[model samples]
Target: MYAAFRDTVSMREVFDSCSGVTDVVSWNTVLGGYVKCGDIGNARMMFEEMPQRNGVSWSAMVGAYAGSGELDVAREMLDEMPAVGRNIVTWNSMITGFARHGLLPLARKMFDEMPVRNLVSWNTMIRGYAVNGEMDGARKLFDVMPEKDVISWTCMISGYAQAGRYTETLELFREMQSESSARPNEVTMVSVLSACAHLTALEEGRWAHTYIDKHKMVLDNDFNLGAALVDMYAKCGKTDMAVKIFHSLDQKNVSAWNALITGLAVNGDVQDCIDVFEQMKRSGEKPNDVTFVGVLTACAHSGLVDEGRRCFQSMSSSNCGVQPEAKHYGCMVDMLGRAGLLEEAEELIRSMPMAPDVMILGALLGACRMHKRFDVAERVQSEIIGLNTRQAGCHVLISDVYAAAGKWGEALDARRVLQKCTIRKLPGSSSSMR
Candidate 1:
């Protein structure tokens, strides 16, 4: 019954229908079912009505509250639990809950207070620190851990990758490989392949791919791994290889299609990007915001203004199943701006629900410079200034626009602003020096 509907109401009727067979264990069974489904209201009511409670009962309630992000309530329950009932599993559940919610400080405090430390306890705390970008603390704990598992290694590797420390990510993977007991799993390989992609280390990527093939690692249901492989190959200027792997994928989820579409866009295969998008739509795959970002980017790069406009409009038309995000708007602005459609671009900016970001303004300013439109140039410059953006490139672009329009005084004023910002540019070496 719990397996099918998780129907607590029916389960209660069955329990009540039984002939004087109700006990703490039976009560706990019902409570556990409620806890499992995250029905906090029912669980709370059951807890209050129970004639007697034990460690499991108390622990179930604590776990449920913690899982629901009510960490303070979970802590209160732990405090109320009888001394005999508070065991390692109960403590671990609380810590796991706090960690899962990114409440690192609370999790760490609990970790310090727990009488017994298990592998799960250590892993949970380390993962908490890693997830919250406290890699230093994670590393400190990771170094002192008595026993290490694949999860410990993977957590650190994933943390480093997420922080853009790609070199460290691969280096850690190498260390994981040298250890006899631990080997890279599907999760580990994803981070490692991502690092390879960032560095464009094709040789290393190939080696990783070979490792997967040699191990006969089944990637049938693991589209993330497959997508990572496609992304890595495409980023390394090997779109042909990416296409082959994409075709070989048995199950192409939205993410898989997104990877191929984005990869094609990055590789300058604009027509292929459009073709893949059309194919994805025809196959009943829903295009996400990221998918359209790639499609709009293709149109932008290929100067397909009409196509870009059509794609942008479809985002909110109930058919696309996506809402235009800031990045999608950025792509459209860049597209229209590049095609000398400044009025259309400005109108689009005004229509944005959210204020235009630096990228959108920059695209418009660039178009202003290209077309030598001082009127629009001054308006965009004012907006950029209103933003108080400290970006040196913005000032330089504004200066260039002013100078191109023979506004020497304004150009000098813009250069002064750039100087006031104190942004340093590296000196370029002469060809003779090289």
Candidate 2:
């Protein structure tokens, strides 16, 4: 009970003064209390002082070490635990710990050695593979599973979605539905809707939305699913429907608001985005860094330079309660550059707390192209090259800037550099309405 409340100090005091002699359960409880408080030293001390040790005691120590990222020690403890006493939970704990740390090979090896396997063991391995970008490995394991659950399917779908394999994500969603088992849940729907948003698969997105409605999946109750729906409709050129859904939500949170704001900004509904931002503020929803990203982006797109400046400045102000991150700074630089304020943009970049990234420099080059400022373009090009960044868009922008200024030799040189750079731009994706 004391452990549940997380009063480790008090729990310790009370345990030490208790009327009864200490038993293994009492010792384990105190160890757990220390672990909960993240006092690994005390937890270890208690573990060593315990009169007797059981699987629970050993598992607690292993988990404590694992939770603190001391995987080597956790493994040592695991090895020390009696082979007869190491249960599925203990093995799962170690596998989960290794997987969490991106030690997939070690995790897989342990997984192979486990005498018993359960759904969790299989799912953990699958998730670990998916997270480590070993989708082929995840697929291989997934195919051989004797029994599959919703989490297993969701993990694969989420993996594909995260890797930006949007088409495959939708295909898998359809496949899951066609299997007649493992019906898509709220989590699965969110992943599917995210893929639809990226692909702009309006028809498929609508079908998913229809599924949610037909299944009575409780959009009003599930903020994440509701937000994903708004995002999908907005990205699919159905901002009106997105707006309708947003207004209908009774329990909107910051994330839900951010989704709507970003969607509106991406759809080029600049005024609407700004208005919604203001509404968000008036509603007392604290705008986070993401919310400002959308606000600054909308301002940049619509050439609202003064508004962008104000928004950027507000990020540092106490009233706004958010700090400007790299993306936010990038948006601000882009806004200034687009308005033909190349000098101001460069000055802002120079004053940044951290080094300006290629995206920031590339925005300046884009501005140079519009205003035909070859000197500024040359400066930005040098900075971009110095970063050793192989962003193809940066090279392409430099070439365009030179070409627009009628510097054919420099343009050709830029193109040559682009050709020499090994990095390639990913192919752009688009989908049509059915």
Q: Which candidate number would show the highest lDDT if scored against the true structure?
A: 2
Report the C-alpha lDDT of model 1 over 1-434, residue by residue, as the tens digit.
33344688888787777868658888889889888877999999999989899999999999899888898899899999999999888898898888888878889899999999989889888888888888889989988999999999999999888878898888888887887377778888888889999999999999999998888776546538888888899889899999999999888888778888998998899999999999999988889988999999999988999999888988887768788888888898888888989888999999998998887888888887888877887888888989988866667778878899999999999889877878544466211100
C-alpha RMSD between model 2 and the true structure:
3.6
Q: What C-alpha lDDT, on a 0 to 100 scale, does residue 112 get in candidate 2?
A: 98
lDDT value for model 2: 0.87
lDDT of model 2 at position 208:
93
Note the Cα lDDT for every prediction shown.
Answer: 0.86, 0.87
Per-candidate TM-scores read: 0.93, 0.91
lDDT (Cα, tens digit) per residue for candidate 2, span 213-322? 99988775653989999999998989999999999888888878998999999999999999999999899888999999999999998999999998888887776778
- CA deviation > 4 Å runs, candidate 2: 1-5, 220-223, 412-434
In candidate 1, which residue pairs get closer than 3 Å at backbone N, Cα or C atoms, i.e. clash?
Answer: none
Q: TM-score winner among the candidates?
A: 1
How well does model 1 score by local distance difference test?
0.86
